[model samples]
Target: MEVAIAAAAVVAMGTGNRVLYKLALVPLREYPFFLAQFATFGYVVVYFSILYLRYQAGIVTDEMLSLPQKPFLVVGLLEAFAAAAGMAAGAVLSGASIPILSQTYLVWQLLLSAIFLKRRYRINEIAGCFLVTVGVIITVASGSGTSASFKSTGILWPLLMIISFFLQAADTVLKEIIFLDASKKLKCGSVDLFVVNSYGSAYQALFMCLLLPFLSKLWGVPFRVLPTYIKDGAACFLNMGSISGCEGAPLLPLLFVLVNMGFNISLLHLLKISSAVISSLASTFSVPLSIYAFTLPLPYIGVASSLPPGFVAGAAVLTAGLLLYSLPQARHFGNTFSQQK
Candidate 1:
């Protein structure tokens, strides 16, 4: 029940993360790289602050914090590259196509977990994943097809997106590995989620700093003017200066950052309590929900978009997939409860 609730929170927050990101990007459209950097660097401060609070409360201990930083370094590098690739690909790929392509994340998670964690899935698990992926592809591609976009942009950007997801899959699997290894180091106590989040985020911010010049160039912002661009972005984000197109200001971006933080924390917590594949599934489940959210009367977006023709069907299939995947666990828990009774 605890894991179920956590997974549900992950789905909700993940949906918010997607919606709020789109909202936040409305004002910072010209400074996409800045927004990306902001989130990456912001996580460092936020995660560390929470880590301190948890430590003070005695939920996090010295041993957990001191377990090992090497794994986090790898996680940081993987996340840095993944973000780079994702941003680059997202620049050219049509929004509709991106969601369809993102279903590859599940495939990557499955393969990486199998290889790294030596975990095998039951037949129903694989089928459930397949249904979830298919449902997302159907839901997202219903009203708009990706063929036209692919024809214009070719395959390189799409391939980069796939690679980006692959890197992300590796990062999640490695974090799971860290948690698994931490059990031994902590002698029956697991490392706190913030320990992983803080160190991983700190290292990612370090790598982001190192790659800033390259990233700015990739985003077509010259290195010398990058600081000015970021300064302007901050102004626009805060609505501090007389910046045009700062209608939403701090609220939208701040909401995005907060919800994005919640989504990440929830995701990591789910990963701690469950497997990487389960965490990924929770994240994946948000795709359709986010699609539905965008159809509502949201601010910044001038008009609410209509639902996709296949939305209901796709959602039903996705729900079934989730239930199918949980069937065995539900049964196991039920049996355990009965025995206790």
Candidate 2:
């Protein structure tokens, strides 16, 4: 029961991270780049802090630390790109679009796994991927209750968002390969989750810092003004002032870093105790919940959003497809997946 609750929390936080981060952009729109950077750096610090504690307790192994950091670097770069693209989409597009487009990652993951990881998926998995693709397109194309300005952003960003998720899929496949190799090589035969998280975040932070100048230029802000931008954005995110008691502009971007990191930790915990299918299903539920959250008349929001025509049905199809895709593996290898680390 506790584990179930934790998994549910993970889904809530996961969806909230996107909805809240997009909300956070209302005020800090000027500092989107820096705010994203802060989230990445904050996660690194938190993960490494816990990692340090574990090390002090003499619970970590040398093999875990030495498990070839290069693959992490590769995945980190992909992560950086995906993060940037997602943040950009959140800023310009509706909260609903982010989840709808992001769900396509599962399809990309399977394709990548087949090509690069040499994994062959069953017919049901392929069919599931096709259904997910159809569902996302249907939801986005219908654009039922999302936003008024999606026309301005056009369909380009959303399509690019799908590609960004494909990058994420590639990263996932690569990381799995790295882990499998490490397990075979190391005497202990398994890597620590914290160690993996810490290294991945560190590499991403390093790359994000490296790209700061470019990002600042794109955001139309100077690199030197990041501190001030973040400061003001934080104040606005906390609702320093309100126009009509609605959340004129809520969502602390820096604070979002905490919640986002929390979501990841919860996901990992769920994965530790259950199968990836469960984790994925929990994540799938976040889509409609996020859409629902966006439609609510929240404090910072000016107006409640409306549900799109087929939003619920489309989401259901996508989620069902994902489940069906995983059914084969779950029936045969559910135990190994739950213990995957």
Give per-residue CA lDDT, model 1, range 1-341, as digits (tens): 88999999999999999999999989887777888888898889888999999999999998887776789999999999998898789888999998888889889999988988889887789999989998898898888877888889998999999999999989999999999999877954799999999999998899888988878888999999988898999999888887898888789989999999999999999999999989988998999899899999999988998999999999988888887776653335643643220
Instruction: Look at candidate 2 and tell me the lDDT of residue 273.
Output: 54
**TM-score of every candidate:** 0.94, 0.77
> What C-alpha lDDT do the candidate models reach, one value each?
0.89, 0.69
Off by over 4 Å in 2: 1-10, 26-30, 85-100, 144-160, 234-255, 268-282, 326-341
Report the number of the highest-lDDT candidate.
1
